[model samples]
Target: MFRLAHISDIHLGPLPRLTPRELASKRITGYINWHRNRRKRLFGNILESLVDDIKSAAPDHLAITGDLVNLGARAEMDAVAGWLANVGEPDFVSVVPGNHDAYVPGSFKLACRAWRPYMLGDDKPASSAGENLFPYLRVRDNVALIGVSTAHATPPFMASGVFDRRQARLLRTILRQAADDGLFRVIMIHHPPVRGATQSYKRMLGIGRFSKVLKEAGAELVLHGHTHLETLYRLPGRSGDVPVVCVPSASEAPGGHRPASGYNMLTISGGPGEWNCRLERHGLDAQSSKFELFHSEDL
Candidate 1:
């Protein structure tokens, strides 16, 4: 079996001291929000413990869905780069950006610069502007991991995502190619694909576009984050229902709403058309600081 571990919304804390000029734009709003809400909600040490648990399991590959930093600052991205290094190398890890990772104008570009290794596909080389890297594909064993970017700068009080027509067209092509190879297609995006997954302000814009593509192209599985809650949603596919699984914030404290640092361990086997998969949810116990199985099911 090919083991894949998925985690998201790490929201690494202890924001680096920033110059007033640094926080002058949209970042200031994130700054206040981080201090007022997220700082208390996120736990850094607990994140390390969770990562350790994942490493102990020794999954063949790790997929992080995003929100690796608070402010999307250069320093924060740099810090997260170090953290990603400890998690695993590019060949062993894949990542997609979240709304927070693109908190302000140009933040996404900065993330592309810092987290390129984890985000770029083997066939797609880096561009000077770092703009067109999304929808990248990395094949591992019999699984094809396609990372899509929904992250973009939004207005204040809005935590939305956008997957434009360009990206959707690209995703459909990848899905087809991967399926042709008899690979288990797994799509990793930072935002939930369907509507009503979150409040209107935080919802993914143009979700209909995504749904249309998925309905036509089909995929074996879809994985996402951004709600900070554990959720499961199945969308229509050509052959059958596709399993969409969401992992809660990987650094969330234990007291908040579904506030458990957790991840999904997906065990996939079987040949191309007859893929057998089981998902096991593991969470860090508050008292023990160790991972415990909370849920498991076949996909």
Candidate 2:
């Protein structure tokens, strides 16, 4: 069996600290608003606990669907890179950028450059025909991991995302190739493929098109992060049912009760066309510093 662990939305670093003058003048109002709603300062320790938990579980591969930083600040990106380095084993971890990771213009590219060393898979050849925003195809012994960046910086209060035409087309091609190559394809992205589950204002803008491509390609499983809630939804495909699993944030607390911070461990067995998967949730107890199984989904 092959085991894959999926987690997302670490949002590392504390709230931005603006200069007194800037704050007083409302020059940094955006930062202030974000801080007011974000998890205050619980992310770092929570992430540490999560990493320890993942280490113990020791999945064959790790996929992080995005929002590694809160505002795409350079310092936050650096912190995120450091944390990933601390938790990730080379060739085992892969990530895709989320909307927050591209908070400002050009920030997504910057984060990709800074975090490239931790990215898994072979370097693309010069003639490769995919969007180069860390969009990659990774071949593990038992699975083919295809990652795509759906991150885009939108206007303030607009958290919508887009996959762009290039990435969208490339994704179709990659999925077809992987299927022909006889690998269990797992597509990872930051935004959920389903629509209406998200707030109407912040929904993934081009999700319809994205979903169409995915359904046509017939991926075995799809994973996304950004909802900050644990959810499982079935998307129809030509071959059969495709499961899209959305993991809650590893560290987040907007209000009310904080959902459990954990990751999904997926075990796949049997050959192509006869494959089966069992998903188990592994969570960390902050007080005890121990990891335990929180839930399971039979698939």
Candidate 3:
């Protein structure tokens, strides 16, 4: 069996002091929001404990869906690169950017450059990691992992994601090829593609195009972040419902609308025709900081 661990929305904190120019754009709002709210709720110590737990679990591979930083600052991106390394090596960790990772115009590209090592596919060279190469494919054992970026800059107070025509085309092609290879395909995106997964201001655009692509080319699983809530939504596929799943922010403190930060552990056995998966959810306990299993189910 192959074990894949999923986590997202780290929102690594203690924001670096921003230059006036940096705050001139959309970051001003994020800065204020962080100071007033996130700073208190999102803690680095909590995140550290969570990472330790993940390492102890020793999943075969780790998939980080995105939002590793609070602001799309160069410093934040730089720090996140180091953080990712601490979590695992590039080859063992697969990542895609989230809405916050690309918080402002040009930030997404910057993040692609900084986090390139984690984002690269097996076919791409180290130098190619900086480009906007979406739908990157990496085959590991019986699993075919595809990284899709829904991360793009948006106006202030808007945390929406986009699934453009170019990405859609690339994704459809990748899905079909992976299916033909008979590998258990897992599509990693920053936003949940299912409708009503999030509120209007934070909704992911291009749902129609995305669903159409999925219906045309079936996939085994879809993983995402950004909602900061553990959720399961099934979307229509040619054979059966495709599972779209997410977990809360990796840095979110216990309580509130968002549950405590956690990671999804998916164990896959068998193959294409009769793939079996057991999902084990682990996270912070409401009354204590100890990491423990919160939910388990077969999918």
* Candidate 2 lDDT by residue in tens digits, 264-293: 999988767887889898766655655678
The C-alpha stretches of model 2 lying farther than 4 A from their native spots are: 16-30, 120-131, 253-255, 284-289
Candidate 3's error at 259, in angstroms?
0.3
Candidate 1 TM-score to native: 0.97
TM-score of 3: 0.97
Q: State candidate 2's TM-score.
A: 0.89
Cα displacement (Å) at residue 206, model 2? 1.7
User: What lDDT tens digits, residue by residue, belong to model 1 across residues 128-155?
Assistant: 3355888899999889999999998998
lDDT of each: 0.89, 0.76, 0.89
Which candidate, 1 or 2, has the higher lDDT? 1
C-alpha TM-scores of all predictions = 0.97, 0.89, 0.97
Instruction: State residue 255's C-alpha deviation in candidate 1, in Å.
Output: 1.0
lDDT of 3 at 181: 91
Q: Per-residue lDDT for 111 in model 3?
A: 93
Residue by residue across 177-267, what tens digits does model 3's lDDT show? Answer: 8888989989999988988888999989999999998899888899999999889988887578889989889988876667888999999
